[model samples]
Target chain A: MLSKKQARAFFLGGTLVTFLIFIGLTIFSLSKDVDQTNHENITEAVVRGKDLWDHNNCMGCHTLLGEGGYYAPELTKVIDRRGRPYIKAVLMSKVPWQPNGRKMVAYGFTNEQAEDLIAFFDWIDDIDLNGFDRVVSPLAKDKTN
Target chain B: MTLYKGKRRTTTALVLSMGLFFAALLYLPGMLPFDSQVTDSFFRWWVVHLWVEGVWELIMGGILSFLLIKLTGVDREVIEKWLYVIVGLTFLSGVLGTGHHYYYIGVNKIWLIVGGIFSALEPLAFLAMALFAVNMYRKGEKKHPNKLALYWTLGAAIVSFVGAGLLGFAHTLPQTNLYTHGTLVTAMHGHLAFWGAYAMIVLAIISYAMPNMTGRKLYDTGRGRMAFWFSNVGMVGMTVAFGVAGVAQVYMERIMKIEFMKVQEMMEIHFYILIICATLFTTGILMYIADFIKHGQPTDEALIKE
Candidate 1:
């Protein structure tokens, strides 16, 4: 097995293995995660929708891709769940969206902008994240108590 | 340094600062906001990154030195040598490691390479500390009878390596950082690194110093053992909850391009798990603090050696 002189080797080797697992996960996941590769199909409306999303700071109220304020519901799968029209209606109408007593900032969206934002959501919605958010997390099972 | 007085006085190596570290916590108090999100975020990150890579390391060194001397019963010469090496490694990798903060701050292109390399090395300093502790532990002929203090001392060293060193390097590399940046992945590392390196050490120091300060030999108590295990297990569970939430967040929001708010809703249950875990962690800490208080005010008689 290992000798006293080989202790440094044990340290180096163990650390090296852990290092390998980390970097390996990084490379594998990052490459697979670039799911929206068909930017070739990105339209002007979708581009404008993205711009609106940014300038309006919808992220200030709602989360996008799990990055944002916790005051609003997630919009990542909104298009899939409610369809493009629903998203457009929500943005276009002057509606109150408060979850757990926190208020969302009101934004006035025009028909054209709403159309563009809808397209953008549709574009991103097509990107594959496998089974993410499709159901309740198994890790949350029986532990919510 | 002379201009400062009272609590502001630069005690120890002139680097032990809870100022910037605590100031950074005040920067972002969870669910709070700045009027200008962009500028606000930049400064918030400045607090966090500067803290972990900065004064917190000095705190680690100071506490480790005190504990090693008290527990290891080793020659001061050997311990001080390790202290010098740790301090050197800390500043060397750490200052440059601040560049990692710049990558997210919308700074210059040079920070990409600079932060990447240095931040990667940040773990090396922590690793050295780990090796130092375990090695000294092995070499020492007499282990202190205070079993709880030893648990904490050794735990701080080893866990810091795993949490700060390994988990940190996981995302420190720019190639990975570019993708994992700002996602729950960062949260995962942040929780573990902060808990392992900073929180655990402080607890370890308190565990060591409490008995000395109070002259109470409570180290052998069941409550002491319970406090240690409950806190550690609760934190590890919390780390896992945060990890999955971050991963799901990244996958749903970043990868699948889900509407961000919807993803947050999906991950709501995980936060519930986080709350449960946090409760356990807080209870454990409260138990520790309560026990420390029960010993009453530190007295001259308590300092009397057996």
Candidate 2:
């Protein structure tokens, strides 16, 4: 039995309230006091690495922080699971890196660019993922065990 | 501006405009650097999570309402009123439902509780949508001869409820998502959700508009009807394939603690099935395009009646 006027009121009112609360929560969570991302460690190399990650659309296959195409492995704890040298070799390799039959596009990154991506991975490996790090890469857990 | 020139401003316009505003807001989170994973991931949901679940639902509701009004010959006042209620339910549940993505992304524990409760309610909006569409069809005195369009319109509502509502609810909770978060399971839910909700609605509109614009009443053709069934059945088959592969991956990778690559290799068969189903889906789409080509360019003669 709701009239159009009342229904419109409900829509506008509900939207306004929820939007404000969402903004408030965003501000609260991102505030420095509750920070869990190790924000201070983002160096120039890490920024460049992120640029490379985005530019190459690495997320087209690989997942970082449990977010990406599921076509590739979860790279949230990649540095811990696979050593830097192995990752570097893959990046610097002229041909595609086919580990278990899945082919990865070979960027043939220079040493410095590879190092920057490694730094980015290293930085990512350190973020507090609310225990998702433990869940995503069991190899890290095995190492600790 | 020209579209709205002589027409009185309606609720559909207002809701759709609001959806556009939210779409523009999707850019805000992307401008921030990935400097802080917590902040970056947190705000990233403002785009990713908000779009499909939040404002996009508003857009869907608006379009669904418009379609129901036209296809069912329902009263504008009644349809608009329900549209308001549906949009209300969407924002009420969906805004806080953003917390679901925040559960494991290094945010506070408050999100676990907030996201769990709110996202559980998110299905209600879709349920309301399905009910609204059906009820409007029943109440309608006029049956628009465009049965193909009607099928798509109703299909969008019902399928969205199942794909976006039920399937999304299946893995939305923090406890289940913890195990399934990054696995192929997310892909399973995502494919059907997008196909049913956004993709089907867009197809519905296209189906409705094509004949009117081209002056070709092709809705009764076997090809048109076949396009609907084949595409929908193919999509469902693909969803099952992905679901099977995803569940196997979650069990092997997350629970058994198998290495990611080994688990992926174990699930290669599902990808084959996915490819097969994808071929079926592609065939349907190609047929639809062929039909569209047959409709030819819209002539001024068709527009003259308007």
**lDDT tens per residue, model 1, B1-306:** 432555644222333444334444645533344332223343554556656765567678767766877788887557655665665676567656766654533233455676788788888889998998888888877778788888888888888888888888887876666556556676777787888888888878877777776877767678888888888888888888988887787678555656556777788999999999989988888777777777646766666644
In model 1, state the lDDT of residue B82: 65
Error of 1 at B56 (Å): 1.7
In order, how many clashes per candidate?
Answer: 17, 0
CA-based DockQ, model 1 = 0.06
Report the number of the highest-lDDT candidate.
2
What would the TM-scores of all predictions be? 0.63, 0.95
Model 2 CA RMSD to the hidden true structure, in angstroms: 2.1
If you superpose only chain B onto the true chain B, what TM-score does each candidate give? 0.82, 0.95
Model 1 vs. true fold: TM = 0.63
Give iRMSD, candidate 2: 1.5
Per-residue CA lDDT of candidate 1, range A1-145, in tens?
Answer: 4342243344335445534543353333234243222445578787677778778888776644434644555565466566777676667777664544455554658999888888776665554332222321211112333
